[model samples]
Target: MTGDIAFGAGWQKTIRVGRDYISVKLDDPSFAASVYASLAETDNGDYALIWSR
Candidate 1:
């Protein structure tokens, strides 16, 4: 799946990691390179956005 950032310039595309976390690739024209991140569930039922190198 693909989605645009709310009130932001960039967009995100879902990536299949075959794990419990939700992986995505983010990109924008101003960015030098695409960023990869994952949303992992926290103990409080919230999600944390973890940036990957």
Candidate 2:
């Protein structure tokens, strides 16, 4: 579970196992639209998504 698209920021409850096993489940249409806004470079030199509020 590298990329985590959770409702809130956490490691326990929102722990992502794997992409094949767990894809981000955002059923909330409004929340979904807000979460997927843009992409940005992470400090780890890898790419990650920038979710909007």
Candidate 3:
């Protein structure tokens, strides 16, 4: 969570509740590509992924 998350962005999301903390990162481009390819092979129809703050 301390590295590049996008073209020029870094460490995009951080959250803490009580004594716990969490950091999130964007999926690696290659991994994302592979996921999309696998999804295509399944022909699961169109879908959408949404993220919001």
Top lDDT model: 1
Which tens-of-lDDT digit does each residue in 1-53 have in candidate 2? 58855463322122244221122323355553543333444558776654445
What order do you get sorting by lDDT, best first? 1, 2, 3
TM-score of 3: 0.21
The model with the greatest TM-score is 1
Kindly provide the TM-score of model 2 when superposed on the true structure, using C-alpha atoms: 0.26
Q: Pick out the ten consecutive residues of candidate 1 with the lowest summed lDDT.
A: 6-15
lDDT of candidate 1 over 1-49, digit per residue (tens): 8986642232344437633666667776777777777777777888898
Clashes of 3: 0
Q: Give the Cα-based TM-score of candidate 1 against the true structure.
A: 0.54
- Better-scoring candidate (TM-score), 1 or 3: 1
**What are the clashing pairs of model 1?**
none
Kindly list the per-residue Cα lDDT of model 3 for residues 1-53, writing each as its tens digit: 49744622223332253322223334555654321111111236553333332
lDDT of each: 0.65, 0.40, 0.32
Report the lDDT of model 1 for residue 53. 42
